[model samples]
Structure formats: structure tokens, C-alpha cells
Target: MTTEIIDHEEVHAFTIRKEIEIAAPIEIAFEAILDELGADAQMPDGKSLSMKIEPWPGGRWFRDLGNNAGHLWGHVQVIKPPTLLEITGPMPMSYPAVNHVQYRLKANGNETFLTFAHRAMGLIQPEHRDGMPEGWTQWINQIRERAEQKARG
Candidate 1:
């Protein structure tokens, strides 16, 4: 077998962080996060992904495709109601990589500050890296919309 060495740039890691303010309480924002990332998960085009999060330490975060077939996105490393959540796993990478995602919430009177971060290392592909920011932003926007809608009701 022949050995091939990859370029340093091709194997580099990355981190993405985004902070958004929601016109909703911390609890509502947190619940919106769970909903958007879990049962209410969807593609940019609004197609449901049927995702699920067990919501406890060591719980599974995955997409259920039915018939016992699905994709394991990650495991809940930490979960604190109305405050923080951290998960570790492949998370849509599906390759020789490790990923950690965190959602932190802070309450400010009647508003909430939501901070999200995703860090990964390994053979991450160009397309995945390029698309992640937009994809994550879409999810974040959805969470904000959901929370704000509930708050307005």
C-alpha cells in the first residue's frame, strides 16, 4: 500500500461562535433551542429532519430515519435547564473528526442572550466547513423566531 501525506491546511481545525439577543425570556429561548435542535429540526428549505435529544448527561442526539436507521449526531455532555447545553460527537461530519457544540443562555430582564459555539478537529472537508456557518445561522434564526413568536403570544 502506498502512503499519502495530506496538506496541513486540509487537516486544520475550526471553531465557530455566534451570539444573538432574543426578545424572550431565558426559559423560552432555551426551550426554543431544544425544539429547533430536536423534534423541530429542519433543513434550510424547511424539511423536517426528525431529530431527537435525550436531554441528560450522556444522552444521545441523533436523527431518526425510522426502521432503526438513523444518524448519531452527538451525545449530551452537559445540560443545565435555562442556561447551558454541551454535546460531543461527529455532528453531521460523518468522518474522522470530533466535534463539540455548546449553547449558553443568559437572562437580561425580559430578554435573553444566546451564545452558540461549535468546535471541531480532524479531516474536515471543505464543503462542510464552508456550509457550517450558514447552516448554524439558519438554525439559530429559527430558534429566535420560535422563541419570539411564543413570547408575543
Candidate 2:
């Protein structure tokens, strides 16, 4: 499971990579990321945010808003179950901006080493770009917590 995110380094002006080691198996970690939240999925504050992933190359990872109006977060560019997953064309960015996200996992003893990277190019919105790393850190943390908890169950 080897891959890298390429970019320059001025914060939002380049690619961002965040890594976390979780106390869970790679499979658990991977599943935690790919599992679809049912239609009623919502943010912690109750805002609608449906999420699902098909977990296969060329599969879709998206948020399904009601009435079929949903955001195409990205397409699974590559998937080597429990090890690597790459997605391209994510949203929260429109035309003139494109994003690529990758999640790499490696089993270590009984846990998993997870690496997440997001690369964006084009006219990135200042606010969006500014919050990306932090946003992704929070997102990855939440998923890590879930994976660890599931492992203990």
C-alpha cells in the first residue's frame, strides 16, 4: 500500500495530507469509511448529509440529497480493499477546481495506519481551501473513533 500526494506547500495553496493510527484492523478501518449511512443520515447538528460509497474502482462516493439531488463527492479511482482507496473529482468545489482524495491503510500488529491526503487545483475558494485540512482532520478523527469502537465490540 504505497502512494503519495504531490503538491506545493502554502497551506490551501497546495495538497494537504493527514495521517492517523487507529486501534483497529485495516479491514475495520476501511469498512468504517465505506459503509453507507442510511437515507436519514444527518450532520451532528441535524443537517442532512447522506453518505455512501460503492467501494470499487469507478464506484461513486456521494451524498444523496432527497429527490435524487445529491453531490457527487468523487469517483473511486482505485480500491485495494483494506489497503488503499483513491477518489477523484470531489465536491465542495465547483468548476475551475478539482480535488483528489486518497486513503491508505496498512495493518500494524492489530491496528491500522491510515493516511489521508487531499489535493486540489484551480481557483480554490479561500474559505473552503482554508478549512480543508482542519475539516479533513475532524472527519478522519470521527471515522477513526468509529472504527476503534467497532473493533472493541
Candidate 3:
């Protein structure tokens, strides 16, 4: 048996940032985010992912597969309700990588502005790196719809 090594000159790292305006109160928008990212999370194709988030410092963000099995997405690093949430861990990646995710909400009268960022580095595959931007956009759009629907009712 022989050992083989691969050398890379460029580091694999990326940051995705998105800002969305929601036609709802900050509190409502924040709740929408929590709901969307948690049990209500869906793929871009609208299928449930069965995700769960514990919204506090040191809590977990993961997917529940049942039968005492699950995928650990991340841990909550900081949480300030209706304002900010930060998590750090490897999300949905089975390879060597570190990820950080943040959600921030700001209120402007009856409108809410949400800023989201997901940063990761190390051995990221092309599919994940390429798909994240579009996935995040769809998720954000879902959150907006949920919030606006709540506001309308």
C-alpha cells in the first residue's frame, strides 16, 4: 500500500450574503425565519427536510431522521430573539469543512429587513458550493411569504 497526497494552491472558502425586505413586523418575520429553518424547512422542490432548531446559546440546529438518528447541522453560538441568531458547525456536509450561519432582522416601522449570511471553508464539493446561493434564495422567499401571510391575517 502507498500513501498519496493532493496539493492545492487555492483555499476553498466562500461567503453568501442575502438581504430581503419583508412586509411584516420584525417579530413576525423573525418567527417566520425560525419556523422556516426549523420543522417547516423544505427543499427548493418544496419537500420537507424535517429540520429542527433549538433557539438558544449552545443549542443544536439539525435534521431529525427519527429512530434515534439525525444529522447535526450546527450549534447555536448566539441568539437574540427577533434580532440575531448565529450558529457554527458543518451543515449538511459530510466532508471536512466548517460553517457559520447568521440571521439578522431589523424593523423599520411595519416593515422588516432580514440579512442572512452563510460562510464556509475547506473541502467543499462543487454541488454544495454551486447550489447554496439558489437554495438560500428560495428559503428566504418562503420566509417572506410566511411572514406576509401572517401579517395579512
Better of 1 and 2 by lDDT: 1
Instruction: List pairs with backbone clashes in candidate 2.
Output: none
Model 1's number of clashes is 0
* lDDT scores of the candidates, listed in order: 0.93, 0.78, 0.93
| lDDT of candidate 2 over 6-100, digit per residue (tens) | 66634334689888999999899888877523243446565757877677788887887779888887888998988988888846676566788
Model 3 residue runs over 4 Å out of place are 1-10
Name the best candidate (by lDDT): 1
Give residue 148's error in model 3 in angstroms.
0.7
- Cα lDDT for residue 151, candidate 2: 98
Model 2 / residue 31 / CA error / Å: 0.7
Error of 2 at 87 (Å): 0.3
| Poorly placed runs, candidate 1 (over 4 Å) | 1-10
Over 4 Å off in model 2, which ranges? 1-13, 36-48
What is the number of backbone collisions in each predicted candidate, taken in the order shown?
A: 0, 0, 0
